[model samples]
Target: MAGYVVAAILLFSAVAYFVGRAAGERFVSANGDQVHSLPGYHGAFVAVWVGIPALILVLVWLSAQGSVIDGLVLGGLPADLVAGKTPSEINLLLSEIKNVAAGHIFSEPTPEIVAASQALLRWDEIARWAMVVVVLAMLIGTMFVARLRLAPRFRARTEVERVLSWLMIACAVSAILATLGIIVSLLAESFAFFRMVPLHEFLFGLRWEPQIAIRADQVAGQGAFGAVPVFVGTLVISCIAMAVAVPVGLYTAIYLVEYADERVRNIVKPLLEILAGVPTVVYGFFAVLTVAPAIRQAGSLMGLAISPNSALAAGLVMGVMIIPFISSLADDALRAVPRSMRDGSLAMGATRAETMLKVLLPAALPGIMGGILLALSRAIGETMIVVMAAGLIATLTINPIDSVTTVTVQIVTLLIGDTEFDSPKTLAAFALGLMLFLVTLALNVIALTIVRKYREQYE
Candidate 1:
């Protein structure tokens, strides 16, 4: 692996050198004007094409070669040595065989395994050398082809820029496709869940008590599939989070964009980002140690019995987590508003506050709404703070100060230990994941739609 990595790096470097030379090439045309673009772009274009495909081939070859070689070597081993083993045992035997070949397996070994190991090592080594030769040949051929194409009107620069754009689009497509793939996979699993527990029961049932008997003789309570209790908890916490984040974050953005001096914005913006940079686990601890206790004390003072792990605590910390999202988006949206609007408002004797409230904010409302959608998504999907701060009981309640669980926390609980793959407990996580995906997707779609409508109105 190390040798392959080193060889791949060298091949990439060589490709880069050649491609750079081709991209920015220039030659005086008949009218004495310089060529349209430099030759470096041409070089880059060839490099990207050559290196990309060959690198892909190398990776595929590397991944498949071991399994192909192993199958051949293992098949050649004596039947008695390989027979009667489970698939996992067969894998273990194969690993031992490899280790023996490499002189690392530390137990008494059968001659058949030793022989198989030797054969595998020999073939693996041969395969590596063959790959090295083929890849080098490919690199050389591509370089030769590129040099042949290096001429006055190669148009390499345009081709390279086009490739770069397509590459970025491919990256974005991958992200979207990955999200879609996850949703599909979860939907499949959740469909299985719905088959076991009816759709209406899972969606509207008010109690969530999941327990299944390990053995036929073992006694267990009927597993209730009602998700309403958790459904309500999730809603309450999310609303509290939004309530906290929106006012504070929007005000912060307004202050930074319309009120604060440049130096304060410079300092404050990074500080808010720093808050966003803090890991969720750290926030979880913050909720458990600081926020949860504070809420409990405050609840006590108010003559209320607030659980240590309550919705309010989780929601408040989540609001802190989401503040950066809204503030940053709001700031950008506010900045994008034309200066003329603020000037016009001011000329009419509107104060900064009045102008921001009446003109700038309304004009930037779509973008602000987009940011809130993003923040809402964050709140919905948050796991750590809620897991730590919200107690793990799914009850149908709307009180923010009561102990309750969210979907993420339940998913985490359902799958945290040694679990059977086919159990309903494990499948529940995927069902919850599907629901979360659909919800977040709906919010994002709405946000984009509103923003688009706002853009058209402005235009």
Candidate 2:
């Protein structure tokens, strides 16, 4: 019903725009040279009035209806059944009622639940009908007022521009508020985690266990939250990935830009970028099922031990996954170098290789470095490839052939199943997440600093 109302409102708004424009044109012709804005501006003014207010009201109604219905349904429940339950318990009961109301289950519901579901469905229908009526009335009334206000000398364009400026400001403010909300949430949960485990221990201690027994009598040992080992593993894998991606991707970009024929370059560049669109899970599978086993076999032949799941396997596959990102960005940066730079280098009697190495490459260094930093961030944040190819045993090691886990993997493992939300085990995920955010932020800052410094020099 709500969807139908929206569709009707849209259709009405479109009709209003054409009618409003015709009215403006007629008014302008009757009082020539008196009109200040174009006919199209009057049309847009009417369309905005017809759509924005109605849409805002519809959104407000939808947001409020759920809580209003929930309160009504829960308020009428039997006093005896609701007497001793906590808020969480009440919420769980409501979820079950909702599920039953939606016909998600085949089993019979209790009498109280059945009553509540019926009440909820009735209220939902009433709300939907009320919303439809209110929205349509608003669309009609606003459009009527806007059409009446359209005059020969009305400043329709100015009014329309003012509304658009406010909309832009609102969108900007919403994004800033969203970012602040995320930071506040992370800080609040991280503080709770730190109360259970000291900040210093989490930051500097070498071990990385995060399991905490839910009950005192549970057999599990108390978990350590040292994060250094996880950090080390992340660094090792990321370094290995960068080692494979940077030189290879950059060279590929150079070949496509400076050496390959136009036909060959066109064919090759898209194929290279196809790597970026391949899902990360596919890379994970390739790492686990294909790359890891091959590495193990090769290592065995060389009289070296390699884990079935190793950092090297994850890093190599991740590097392959990141190649497209680096190559595309580097190609753009390389292409941005002026053709005159190459021509001048050739005029100086420099060979093509020397010109590329000493002139074009240097000129494009900032962009190439930017691409590399971006790829490094990609490698650091990657989860699936590491989860499948690198085993989840956090060990403080630089050996790429050893099994290790990253911060993302640990955060995921800690929060996987049903667990106490406020417990340190769960809060630890927030702590790790905050650290990852900070690390990525630092990388971005560093990249910007380098780019700005070199950009100024080159310019």
Q: Which candidate has the highest lDDT of all?
A: 2
Model 1 lDDT-worst window of ten: 22-31
Question: Candidate 1: how large is its RMSD?
Answer: 4.3
- Per-residue lDDT tens digits for candidate 1, residues 136-208, read 7777677667666666666767777887898899899999999889878888889888888888988888889
* All candidates: TM-score: 0.82, 0.92
- Please state every model's RMSD to the true fold in angstroms: 4.3, 2.5
lDDT of 2 by residue, 252-286 (tens): 99999889999999899999989999999999999
Off by more than 4 A, model 2: 1-6, 24-35, 79-86, 103-110, 216-219
For candidate 2, what is the TM-score?
A: 0.92
* Candidate 2 lDDT for residue 189: 99
**Model 1 misplacement above 4 A:** 2-7, 10-37, 66-130, 148-155, 158-176, 214-222
> What clash count goes with each model?
17, 0
